[model samples]
Target: MGSEIAVRVNGTLPAFSDFGSDNERAGEVESNPAMKVNTSCSLIIHENGKPTKHILVDTGNGVCNSVKQACNDLLAGRCVIDAILLTHSHPDRIDDLSLIVKEFDNVHVYCTQNCWNDVIKKFPDLQSIQHTSVEAGKTFEIDSVRITPVSVQHSNDALGSVAYVIESEGRKIIFGWDVLTFQNPNDPLLKGADLFFIDTFTYNPHPETNHLSVLQAYDLLKIWNPKEAFFINYSGFADFKNAENPYARVPKKPMTSDELAAQVMSDTIPWGYGWNERVKVASHGMVWRSTKQIEFMSPQFSEDMVKLFTEQNYVFSIKKGKKALEVTAETDIKNISYEFIKYDVESEGRRIAATTKGGFLAKPLQMLLEIDDSSDPAIVKIKVGGGTNIKMIDQDVSYQKDIHVKRVHADRLRDFLMKLTS
Candidate 1:
């Protein structure tokens, strides 16, 4: 994507954000990844560096506080939603459909014809909403983002079930959670993806839901070879504390997020081709940003120009404990959207980031990608290299005092009239 496309892990399970609700949140369950209804929601921000399109895949538990906050962020604080792609008709998946529609009245919902009947009947408040009955093969568009619905094998509990392969700003992402397998796994649209958010409910098949096991998700990752993948909707209860699981690989206990990450890394290391960097166990507030060439930048660099947006800063992490924030940075630089281009050296009218304190680069870096903020700018306190220790220029620099006029997502209201005549 020009600016970038970003995904926010709003929720991961059907449980509330507290303990006891899911069997019991005591003991190991405390770290077993609290369930909050899984969904792969994201924003597609284009050249302006402001999100004009937001996509929600599988509205799990309807709209919780975190999910509501995400919708607000993507809509620029406006009570609106661009579109919602329903993955299946499970009650947990579409429980709050009416609430979402009631809040954002104009929000368009995309689901199967059966899903429409399922939701409308269950949630009568959505009777007047605008809904599109999506087909398996037909591709639809909401602004510049194009989405193709694909059939997936799940329980017959719902009238129908489907997955989505989304095409946004030159990136193809597949969001197919709560599925055993795709009806057409080899569909052309599923190939050569930039990112994938797939169901990894349990390591072993469960008796309740028809979702993919962790191994199955790994197999698909090997076949598709997406630039990156996120495993979501993990079941903390599906452990073998006293029971003999069907598989040898199924953990004796449910793997914590850290344990899952370590196992995923270990498993993919044998597969080679750097699959370790490609797959991850996604949790609430996890984010993935797309990287591309800065073709639109002017000839505004010195030979000694340092790079600001490098692969080192590609996978930015949100700190634990606090809520994760993924919002757009609207700026008019060589593009990598400027969080704040202070202490800059101007090269042919374009500003390059000069470090007030120390930096990985010695200024004069190419600004080829859009500047993006992975979290609340207030707490986004990182120097250079995005919290990674890499090669740096030893300038021995420090800031006397610093102030900022930044394009931050969580800071303030978006000024629609950028070029306002005072």
Candidate 2:
């Protein structure tokens, strides 16, 4: 058996002069004049038997004062953080980094060149400590753990954002925060892995340039298939508990093409997705874990599959003598509909076969398998109103449906489908 490592959460907020308690200070920090804090900071403790490695992913607003106190109070001063890994240069993520560097003399700070520049530009006082400017596809080792930085698209205009893939004790874990989407769904760097932590900022029809919606994150969960996946970087609009659709948020802006290419480099960056069950409404100190196992519960699909079906506009049709059936539809982003035509066929003997299409068909279908089962051999045909389409296929079929200009579930059906699928 591999080493049993325990992850201790050393999260903290900024220390305000007015607030006497840390909790009160965190509340003030969120609405203060310094910066509009959108997310919290986190510290990960990776211990492999006698050799322990402490990795701090983000230094929240309070300069890590909360983390140091929390660790001392929780772990009785037994935990010694070895290094700091920053996901981005956002104020909420790196405000306390300078304080951390000054306090810990032996700790090595790791971040992208762009993040480094942004930090130095804002806080010139942090120029003294050792800083390693990380590049995409490069791996750095600290004690028994090896960390690889993967570039991610962010809303900033600086160097770029990044996610870390940490390998230790024979296990690989990905820390993906503040990313819009997994750049290339087919990229090898996003293949099989033990665990993944992703952004769950919004749900569907992403609103801004960066950040992942609840629906987008689920779609990624289906593709990456990590043993365990958790959502981070939440917003005030999110309500994890009692949330009918649990994962839903407005989309953000997208990362540039160059940023995407730089982030996904290897074929082994494991995949998984889930909401932040602990902290809802932008609360702090939420965490989740993944169970490292790859099971074929259903067919794993991607954005490419959605595109292929829509681009061809092939409808489902049954041949006089054939066991397989096929259909397709296409549309643009503006006039896109969410209703997907599920292709199903009931053979003369009641053997059922079916598939679905919609604005985001692949992910919904993947989730559908978890709740229901298809029966009978009847070829079902439907159209995915929105522009999204399936990019990949798995099984072989014989019949094809040529659906031309059908618009029954154009609006109501589309809305219903978005709610169900997302």
Candidate 3:
């Protein structure tokens, strides 16, 4: 179960400047080289639950002594880091590699060709350090984990960015960030990830050089159907609490802290969406475990009314108010049952009465009753049903003549009456 592991380190880098305190912001000039917060960097370790032969992913802005301490704590004083895997060669992501190499003995660094060149230019003193350049579609083994790099587009000058697909313990995890979008529909390397961490920088479609909006991420989830998905690379403006845009939707899947810990410990979840999806944004350091399942419950409708509408194949319209669901259905008058009571026809031949359903009797029926005739096809109005008053629209009034009933049908009237009360 302990095949892969990751830890968030403490150190301010230029990338993390947004997360720094205001006082700390003033001291940026003299801050430790390792304390730079250029971007978010995470240390990913892959092992077969062994201290030896572990792999570390992205050392981050390696200047913080606290970060080093955190790494030491995670290692538990076992073997030193065996290898370093770089996602990209940005300064914040790679600046700490030299410090890591200087502190540890015989550590091998693995990166893409462009990333390796960038690192070499910055750390000429560590030229003797062992480095291996990799390309897209290449698979490399790190203990029990298999890592495959997939090419992606980025906003960086060196456009050759790559995301990793890590396979271990019979499951696959995809790490996708910095890519503008999933533009390649036929890329086989993008398939079958059990978990995906995608970049969702904005709530709406504010096109940038590289990044995805929350809506784009949701569309990907519907298409990929990953067991779990998380959004990462989020901007402060895109906080969930402030997410009022209709397009920015959260994942429908359930998640828990224990599940997040398991994903992190196994290194089965990537950094972006997976991490963001599981985050609880309340008080700092406050933890909770929710065992109850969270479900999206829709509005409730009366079972009888729903059944009636379904059976009649009626095209109903629904509107939601503050407290209730308002529904309207149109049906043919002949379908209604009129079994009970008799009518007294006057010389003018019109009958008027209130329905048990609480609606006033209207028009064509009124005209026919006045004429004392059953020969005309007239519209009979059931004024109020289910607390909602029904009004005859243009189609209802113009399409037919009215029928006057001296007595209402017991069964049909009972059904209609039940609809009102129920």
| Winning model by lDDT | 1
Q: Model 3 misses residue 318 by how many Å?
A: 47
lDDT of 2: 0.46
Cα-based lDDT at residue 392, candidate 2: 28
Q: lDDT values of the candidates?
A: 0.57, 0.46, 0.46
Provide the global lDDT of candidate 1 against the true structure: 0.57
| Candidate 3 ranges beyond 4 A from true positions | 1-14, 17-50, 62-67, 183-188, 237-422
Error of 3 at 84 (Å): 1.4
Better of 1 and 2 by TM-score: 1
List model 2 lDDT by residue over 44-139, tens digit each. 443442324457777756536655654654335654657888877877677777677767667677898888888888889778777898887788
**lDDT per residue as tens, model 1, 195-250:** 78888876665545577878888778777778878887776455553257454664
**Worst 10-residue lDDT window, candidate 2:** 364-373
Span of 10 residues, lowest total lDDT, candidate 3? 281-290
TM-score of each: 0.65, 0.50, 0.49
Model 3 C-alpha lDDT per residue in residues 1-422, reported as the tens digit of each score: 35544433233222453232433222432354443433333334546644444455565653434445545544556637677777687665677777778787898987798888877888888779888888878898876778888887766664557777777657766767666655463466566566566665544554553666555665666566565555554443323333455554332122222222232223323445554334211111111111111111111244333212211122232232233333344433212222112122232323322212223653222111122234322223322222111222232332222223223222232333344323
For candidate 1, what is the TM-score? 0.65
> What's the CA RMSD of model 1 in angstroms?
12.0
